[model samples]
Target: MKGKILELLKKNKGDFVSGQKISEELNVSRTAIWKYMNQLKDEGYEIESVSRKGYRLILTPDVLTYDEIKDLLKTKRIGRDILYFNSIDSTNSKAKQLASDGKGEGTVIISEEQTKGRGRLGRNWVSPKGKGVWMSIIIRPDIQPIDASKITQVTAAAVSKSILELGIKNYIKWPNDIIINNKKVCGILTEMSGELNKINYIVIGIGINVNLDENEIPNDIKDIATSLKIESGKKVSRKQLVANIFNNFEELYEELLNKNEITHSIEICKENSAVLGKEIRVIFRNKEIRGKAVDLTDEGELLIENQEGKIQKIISGEVSIRGVNGYV
Candidate 1:
């Protein structure tokens, strides 16, 4: 009911709609309309209430509120059902819980900050309030468990495409990182729950540094992590960025889920690859292999040729590729 009222308020953005009219249109009492308007105000929406003229939306906060998102969202799915949080432990964890609770596919879990944020290899991710895009996308694709890893590739392509649309020259590092000027601006962690042959659900957690202050960055990774503001010298719109990501991701997801194809995403990753044709060190659980990255397989595996001229197709592992002869 409140969502319906907010939709009405947004529809009459700059102009005021009478409380009586709103009540009549929404089939609610005038007091109910007043209560809902006050609730929106408490949620950081600047609403103007006049004597004869009812509520008028003056401005919306910069937060990722549902009303703000519904205005810009264009995808048919992916973000239609969003679970927004000002702060949380992790969007991925929350997304998994919702998926388990039978939430529909394409539900998105987004947070302004994550107290227990994580990255690939179980490392801690620094997510400050209003600093980045911390969100997880819930997917229930029909592909088998073995091919589930390709979802990460799809997410990488989506994020890289979104950044490139902003006119930033970025590269997709193998497996789950986006690099610009040799520093990482984004990371993705793909997790899933499934049986041997069937996947129940997959959660792809994406974290992008957007406008974090340099001082807020952890000293341990300050030299290697960067934000869109730090690189572009301007504050990028988080709302637009998130919307763009969803649009791009939805296209690729439809291709993968409906067509059983990852060709487009694979092509994007290869075109913007940061490690291909470069020397790299692949870190596995037991051993490490050093080689030259030759190409990416159609399934998005990293193909590396060792010093002994032996080719290795790595389906999953941590890779350290030189940006300019050393770590970025």
Candidate 2:
């Protein structure tokens, strides 16, 4: 009911709709409409109420609620069904649980803050309240479990394109990380539950440092971590970025599902690659191999030419660029 009222007011933005008209259209009493309007105001919406003319939506708060982002979204599937949260243990955890319960594809789980946020390899991710994009997407792709790593590349491409569209220069660091000004801005973690021949579900978790300031970043990672606001010198619209990611992701993912290929996504990753043509250290298991990142395979594997003049296809590993951001 509140969402309907908000939609009506947003549709008639810059103009007033009579309370009586709203009551008739929504089949709710005028008193109920008044109550909802008060609730909107309390939620940081600047609504103007006139004596004869009714309510006018003046401004909307910077929030990532379903009602806030629904109108901003342009995707057909990726974010059509969103589970929004003010606080959660982890969006990825929730998404995995929901997917195991037979949730369909393209369901998004978003949260304002993650109490137990994590990154790859069980590393803790700092997710301050209202500071970043902490979301996970549940997808059921008809592909083998071996190809699940490609989803991380797809998501990295989508995120790179979306952030570039916002006029911020960024680069994809191999399979998952998005770098801005040579610092980490976004990270993608793809988790899958499936058999050898089939994939039951894949949860793509994305955590972006969107609005955090220098002081907000943890001191341990402050030198290597940054936010979109820090790089862009202005506040970024989290809702718009979320919508853009979904829009780009849906387009790229459909191509993969329908054609069983990720040529376009791989191209994007290559074009905006941070490690390509640079020396890198591939840390796999307990050993580290130094090589020059030369290219990305069609299946999204990292191609590195070792010093011994042999090229190795790296499926998954922690890659540290030799000279970038002191990552080595």
Candidate 3:
């Protein structure tokens, strides 16, 4: 009922909609509409109520509630069922639990803040209260466990394209991280629970620094992390960003699932790659190899050329671009 009221107000945004009209449209009492309007105001929505002009939606808060994002969403299934939380230990952990309980695919677990947020390599991800995007998605694909890593690439492409849609220049730091201005603004962690031949479910955790200011960023990662607000010089709408991500993700994921090919996603990754044609250091299993990132394979693997002119295909590793960020 409240969502319907919000929808009416949003449709007539910046204009007045009479209480009587709303009551007739939604079949609710005028007194109930008044109460709902008050509730929306308490939830941080700025609505103007005139003596005879009724209500006008002045501003929408930067919130991630389902009511806030439902209207913004344009995807078929990626975010249709969202489990939102004010604060949680971790969206990934909660999503994994739900998936183990036989939750359907495309169920999203999102939180305004994650008390125990973590990134790739188990590094602590700073998810300040109402400051960033901390969410996880549960998926049940029929592919083998070995093919699970491709989901990371697909997510990277989706995130890269979504951020690009916001007029922000960003790049995909192969396998999972999204970089802006040589600093990381987002990270993806893909975890799967299944046997060698059969797969049960996969949880893809995505953390993005959206509206955090300088003070909100931890001191340890200030040099290597940034937020969209810090880069764009404006506050970004988290709901819109979330919708864009789901829309792009659904498109790319459908391609991967239905057609069994991610050529479009691969093209997006290649076009926005941060390490292609650059000298890099690949660290895996306590071994470091120096190579030049030459190309990305059709299967989304990194192709590296060693100093000896030998090409090697890298599936997963910590790739650090030499001379950038002092990582070498």
> Least lDDT summed over 10 consecutive residues: which range in candidate 2?
319-328
Q: Kindly indicate the candidate among 1 and 3 with the higher TM-score.
A: 1
* Segments in model 2 whose C-alpha atoms lie over 4 Å from true places: 14-16, 31-35, 38-43, 48-54
TM-score of 2: 0.94
Q: Model 2, range 1-328, lDDT digits (tens) per residue?
A: 9899999999999999999889999999988999999988876799999989899999988777778887777788899888988789999999999999998899999998999999998989999988899999999998999989989989999999999988899999887899987789999989999988999999999999999999999898987899999999999989889999999999999889999999999999999999999999989997888989999999999999988989999898888888776665
| Candidate order (TM-score) | 2, 1, 3
How do the predictions measure up, each by TM-score?
Answer: 0.93, 0.94, 0.91
CA lDDT, every prediction? Answer: 0.88, 0.92, 0.91
Q: Candidate 1's residue-wise lDDT over 1-328, tens digit each?
A: 8888888888888999899888889899998888988888877789999999788989877777556777677789888888889899999989989999988889899998899999887888989998899999999998899998799999999999998888787999888999987689999999999999999999999999998777877887877888888888888888888888999999998999788889999999999999998989888887888889999988989999998999999998878876553644
Report the lDDT tens digits of candidate 3 across residue range 66-116.
Answer: 788877788888999999888899999999999999999999999989999
Candidate 2 displacement at residue 265 in angstroms = 0.3
RMSD of 1: 2.0
RMSD values for the candidates in order, in angstroms, are 2.0, 1.9, 2.4
